[model samples]
Target: MAAPIDLELKKAFSELQVKMIDTQQKVKLADLQIDQLTRVQKHAKLTHTEITTLPDNTRLYEGVGRMFILQSKEEINNQLMDKQKTADEKIKELEQKKVYLERSVKEAEDNIREMLLSRRAQ
Candidate 1:
């Protein structure tokens, strides 16, 4: 009700707004990362399946910056497995981060609501 309390409440509300925005941005980034990792994992699995069905003498190529170089089937398979593993790990991490960010955003919203309610009750 007092001037100081009112000013403090407004400041706190503003700070929470900023925090919520930042957390939301992080959530969006994490979602994008999760989607990318999912795509990579799917591609890796598909490539691995294709590799298995290919003939022994089949030629394989690895593309690098506008160039394609010959690669052994075994080498490509290993690389694909490694890539899939990395993507899986990154996806897990991003999912956890997304959950945390969602929680943070919810808490901030709740705090903002409480502040508004208190201001109205005064």
Candidate 2:
């Protein structure tokens, strides 16, 4: 007893559901990336602050994938500054992605609602 338009609407709704799920997943992944980058940025800032308080000649061991290499205070400060900058950039990128995904999700939901309303009125 369903009209052709109803069937079409249902199909569209299903597709939207799939899209919404995918978008939600993307948002979640972006949020996780943002969180990770934020932590890295904070850690880098802390390291920079603490390292500056140390004597200039103090030796520091830089960790490289489970191994530590000897480095000077200036070298460590430079590395930390670079890391902080990279983390800031990545966090900004992920935040933008998250905002876009959120907007898409909202739009999809609105379209689904409209379709359902139209079908009901038919």
Candidate 3:
């Protein structure tokens, strides 16, 4: 009877340990994703600045060429802006998830500690 109870406790603890590890990995991945998104956002802003700073005639050929280039840049800028917004939103979501995972890990640790203390008291 005691052996079975000990085995069950060990299994539960092992499962909790795995979950804690998985949560830590997820948090790390989220951090990397946030960093990547930040870099992409910066790059987009820089490209937008370069496009806006181009001289009137120097950046594009006159006539139809000018209109085409201007239109292309506008479309690309819009797309980049959209991507940045999406990345920002994802980063925010990941941050929230990371916080929740951290809390869960803390709670799990506390539970394990409490269980051990109670076992010792018994």
Clashing pairs counted in every model: 0, 0, 0
Tens-digit per-residue lDDT, 1-122, candidate 3 = 56776786798699888988999899899899889988988887887777668754444322355464335555666776887788789888988988999999999888888877877776
TM-score of 1: 0.83
What are the per-residue Cα lDDT tens digits for candidate 1 across 1-122?
38887797879878988987888788888888899899999999999999989997999999999999999999999999999999999998888888888887788778878877887888
Go through the candidates in order and give each one's C-alpha lDDT: 0.89, 0.87, 0.78
TM-score of each prediction: 0.83, 0.85, 0.74
Better candidate by lDDT, 2 or 3:
2
Model 1: number of backbone collisions: 0
Ranking by TM-score: 2, 1, 3
Per-residue alpha-carbon lDDT of candidate 2 for residues 37-93, written as tens digits (9 for 90 to 100): 899899999989999998887889999999999998888899999999999988888
